[model samples]
Structures are given as C-alpha cells and as structure tokens.
Target: MPHTKFPQIIVFDVNETLLDITTLEPLFDRVFSDRRILREWFAQLILYSQTMTLSGIYIPFGDLGVGTLRMVADIHQVTIEESDIAELKERMSTMPAHPDVIPALTRLRDAGLRLVTLTNSASGASPTPMDKAGLSHFFERTFSVETTSKFKPSPETYHLVARELSVETSDLCLVACHLWDTIGAQAAGCHGAFLTRYGNAMLPAPGVPVPDLVASELTVLADQIIGRQ
Candidate 1:
C-alpha cells in the first residue's frame, strides 16, 4: 500500500474478521427464539463492555455473557440452567474460521509477517477458538483484553493490542470487518484494513482513510497487506 513502511506486526480482530460467528447464530436463535431478542443480546454485550471500560468496572467477558443471558432470560421469564451456559461457552471454542482465512493467513505467515490476534472476548475464553480452528500456529500471540476491560472502538483496546505485541503503534496493522474498529485502530495510530465480507456500506469518515485496504475475501486482503498480487 503506497510503498509506505509496512507494519512489523499484523493484528486481527477475532469475532467477525478472522472467525465467522454465523455458525453461532443458529444456536443463539435456538436458545432465544426472537430475532429482536438476539439483537438486544449483542447490543447489550457491547454496551456493557463500554460501560465496564468507561465506569472502571471490569468483569470477565464470559461472566458478562452469562449475566447478559440471565438478563435476557429474566425478561423472557425463562429459567436457564448453569449447564446450558456451559454449553454456550463450549460452542465459542468450536466456531470455525472463514473459508478463505486459513490459506490467506498461511500466506502471510509464510511471508514472515508476525501475526497476532486481539479480541474483546474475555480471559475465561482465551484462544480456544483459534486453537480449535488450527489458527493458533499462525499467530505468535493471542490477546483477550478482558485485562483492559474494554471493547473495540475504544482507543484503549487498540492501544492495548499494540502494547502487548511490543510494537510501535505505527508498526502495527489492524484488520477487521467493522468500521468503528478501523477508526479506533487508526486513532490509536495503527494502519487499518476493512474486511467487508458481505459488501456492507462504508460509514463516511473524513480525511483519515476508511481502510488502507478493503476486500470481500481474506486472501485478497492479505495480498494487498503484503504488497503481493
């Protein structure tokens, strides 16, 4: 990209960018039938993540999910057992990566790019999904900022990633599917790529580029990031 100094470390946002969460949707729907209810669950999850960060109240991301589910269950007047919660946690460890992802990551790793994963997912659920998808080998490290108690779109989360990777903010690249995430990374001084897997509309952001790279597939995005075809 523009022959600028490329980042020494490439950091990825896990949930939507690296690992596809679509498989977990069916399980969520089965547990909470209403689509609107599912939407609220996700909404509150982000809300609480920010709330925890802003208010200086940190909770383990897994515990936060359990609490969010309890809130949903209470509203629906249904009682959920602890075993059901454990099952949901188990599923997080099983969600697979996108079809194009492994080969793309392999290419980057083979090219000698240092890879790492940064996620807002809690410490209780650290790196299991990457391990399950066989992606753990591609990354030199995996970070769950349950330690920071913040989610993406927060400068703290982005900065935490760079700090943990022991790379300069300018020497770290952040690739993700969300616009807010790219903005946060850029704000935190990282080069950014928007992984638009579904061709979603780009939210307008002035001056600062929306994404240094944009691609519908991870393979193409990897090429651009590595200055390949």
Candidate 2:
C-alpha cells in the first residue's frame, strides 16, 4: 500500500473507537433477555441521533441514549424503569478505554502529533467519558457536536473542528471506527483513517471515498501513521 501523508492534527472519535462499550454488556443483559438487544439499542440510538440532526432538532446525546433505550424496551415488550435508565447512563459515563488505546495514543503523542477528540456526547456531562476512562490527559482538546447542533456524518460537524483549530480541512485527519464518519470527514476535504473494530467494516459504496488508512486496531493504526512519517 502507498504510504499516506501524515496529518498535523489527528482527530479521534470516541465511543466504540477508543472506548469499549461492550463493558456495559452485563447492564444491557439485565434490561433485555436477548444479548442482541444491546446491538439493536445502539443502532437505534445512532439512527435517532442522526434523524434529530437532519431534522434540525437538537437533543443532547445522553438524552437520546435514554430515550432510545426506552424505545428499544418497548419494542421488545420489556418493561424498564427510570432507575434502570439512570444506571445505564451512569455506567456509560465511566466506560473503560480499550486495552490498546493508551499505548497507541502515547505513541502518536510521542511522535509529536496533535491529538484531540470529537464525540456526539452531551456538553455538560460530568466526568466526561474521557476523564472517567483516564484518557483525557492525552488529548490537547475535546470537542462535541453539541456546539454545532449536528452529529457525525454531518459536514458541518467536521468543518467545525477545522474552524475551531484554525486549520484547513486538509490538515486534519479523522480516525474513527465508523465508515460513515470517515466518509463525512473526507467529504469535508479532511483525510481519514478507519479502524475496523468489531462489527465495523468498510462499506463498498461507489461514490463515497475510502479512508486512506485502514487497520484492525489503534496500535496498528498508530504504527501506520508513524511509519508514514
């Protein structure tokens, strides 16, 4: 493969990209008998978040998660209480980072790359996911789509990061597990690297741009970035 040019600023996507949501599997099991319900709930959550953004409706990501969980519960004919939702939210705020995250981030930082995070998470959530995961110190800044009232896969959201950093779109490279996210970044003229984590793969869409870099994990992605430099 051809080596990709290094990006001055590396933008990271949170949630499943850096942190492991599977850590909440036990909590999910309590709310529904089927293990597949967790996956469905997350899919619905992302779908609703995108729907709200496209409709010009702004809702905090946390609220969307809770609402989607209730919707999922209703669909499966499962009864869930407010307390159950609260507990899930609590666990979400403190999710653990995947094992490879810290070392990979350290490698990138050590190589003199600027690292920052962009997430669909709410603006005022205490102990933001990064803080709880003990990964906040690695980033130079943290961003949320809440400021733009749009979610990932929206051109404006990616542009907002470039504008905030006073950098041109080409100077930024988004590293994410979701194909839609990388496609959105590339659409906005930023470079992208895709991490094909569990349940994620490159979409064979003809018109969409494929990411310049693809790796199975963050560590490998870091090595690719560093090797190219």
Candidate 3:
C-alpha cells in the first residue's frame, strides 16, 4: 500500500465478499443434481448485472438473480420448479456471514475507520441480506447502486457514494473480493483493496490498475489495512 494513502472511509462489498454464498450449494444440488452449478449461477448473476449496466439498463438485483437461475437451468437442460426458485430466493436472503467477516470487520472498526457498505443489492428493504445476517450494525450506512440505477464497475456508482458522503473519491477505499469491483473504484479515483476470494483474482494486464493491497482472505486484508494505518 505504499502508493496508497490511508482512507477516511472504507466501503465494503457484500455477497461472496462478506457473506458465505456457498450455502446455496444444497439448493443447487437438489435442483440441478450438480452443486457446482451454484458457481455458474453466481457467475451468471455478476456477468448479467454488468451487462445490464453497460447496456444502460436497470432492474432490481433480485429479478436478475431469478433470471440468472433460470438461465442456468436452461443451459444445463434442467427443469427448475417454482419451488426451486422460491427456495433460491429464500436461501439467498438468509446466508450467514463468512466466518472471517466479523473478526475482520471488528479489527477495522476498532481501528476507528469509518466503515460502510456499497453493494449492487437494492437498499431500503426492511431486512436486507446484510440485516438478515446480523451484520448491519457494523456499517455506518449501506449503499445500493439502485440509487444511481447502475451497478459496480460503473463510474456513476462509485461517484454516487462519494457524493453522498461529501467526500472526494480519492478519500475512499473500496474493499471488495471482485477484481472488477476494486478496479472500478480505482478507476473512479478511489483507493482499492482486493480480496482474492475463491474463484477471483487480479487480472494481470498493463491497463489494469493494480489494487493498493491484495490478500487471499478478508482477515488478512483487514490486518494489512490496520498495519498500514
């Protein structure tokens, strides 16, 4: 993090970054008889979300999830019943936080960093996945790209966060497990800390802006950020 200065605020990414999405494996196995389809479905969800954002389209994240699940079923030539879809939606909103999440967040909070969340998931829901996971109290606020009708990697989404907090993009640090997400924040003039969670890693290219910090786990990244401070 030598090239990156300490940040005034830390914005987190949810989903796989904070929550344990693997919990859906059982549902995928029950429906498709292949638990690995959970990974494909998640990739589809992210891919289509970015596709929608780039095409200047906006829809609720939940709708896209349902559509992505169906798309996966169609691709695998599997039949997903209404019950399966209902189960997917229900499980998504109840997944537990990753074991590393609380300890890492506790470390950051104890370090006195202004912690908040900026997710593609829509806000204003009474019991968001974050709230359902009992992690809502750790954040000062939860931001949704729905506020700007865009998704992550879109400059507007990052800019919306900066504007809402009355801070320059440079003063914020986005900590996310997805490279495209951290890259997006950096491109938007914010610092980035990339967490190399499962199925994700840095894209090695001359054009890609390297994250300020890279760690394989959230706890490691949290320690690095605290050590940097």
Where model 1 places Cα greater than 4 Å from the true spot, the runs are 1-3, 34-39, 74-79, 124-127, 198-201, 205-209
Q: For model 3, what is the error of residue 172's alpha carbon versus the real structure, in angstroms, after optimal superposition?
A: 0.7
Model 2 whole-model lDDT (C-alpha atoms): 0.88
Q: Please provide, for model 2 over 114-168, each residue's C-alpha lDDT reduced to its tens digit, 9 standing for 90 to 100.
A: 9999999866656777888999999998989988999988999888889999987
Model 1 Cα lDDT, one tens digit per residue, 1-229: 2435878588998876877666656656666775356556656776887788778788777678779878878888877788768876777668789998999999898888989888888644445778888788898887777656676677877788777766678888888887767878888888888889753447875675677788888999998988932
Q: lDDT rank, highest first?
A: 3, 2, 1
Per-residue lDDT for 225 in model 3?
85
Superposed Cα deviation of residue 81, candidate 3 (Å): 0.7
Best-to-worst order by TM-score is 3, 2, 1
Each candidate: what lDDT?
A: 0.77, 0.88, 0.89
TM-score of each: 0.84, 0.95, 0.96
How far residue 151's Cα lies from its native spot in candidate 2, in Å, is 0.7
Clashes of each: 0, 0, 0
The lDDT, on a scale of 0 to 1, for candidate 1 is 0.77
Candidate 1 positional error at 222, Å: 0.9
Clashing pairs for predicted structure model 1, backbone only = none
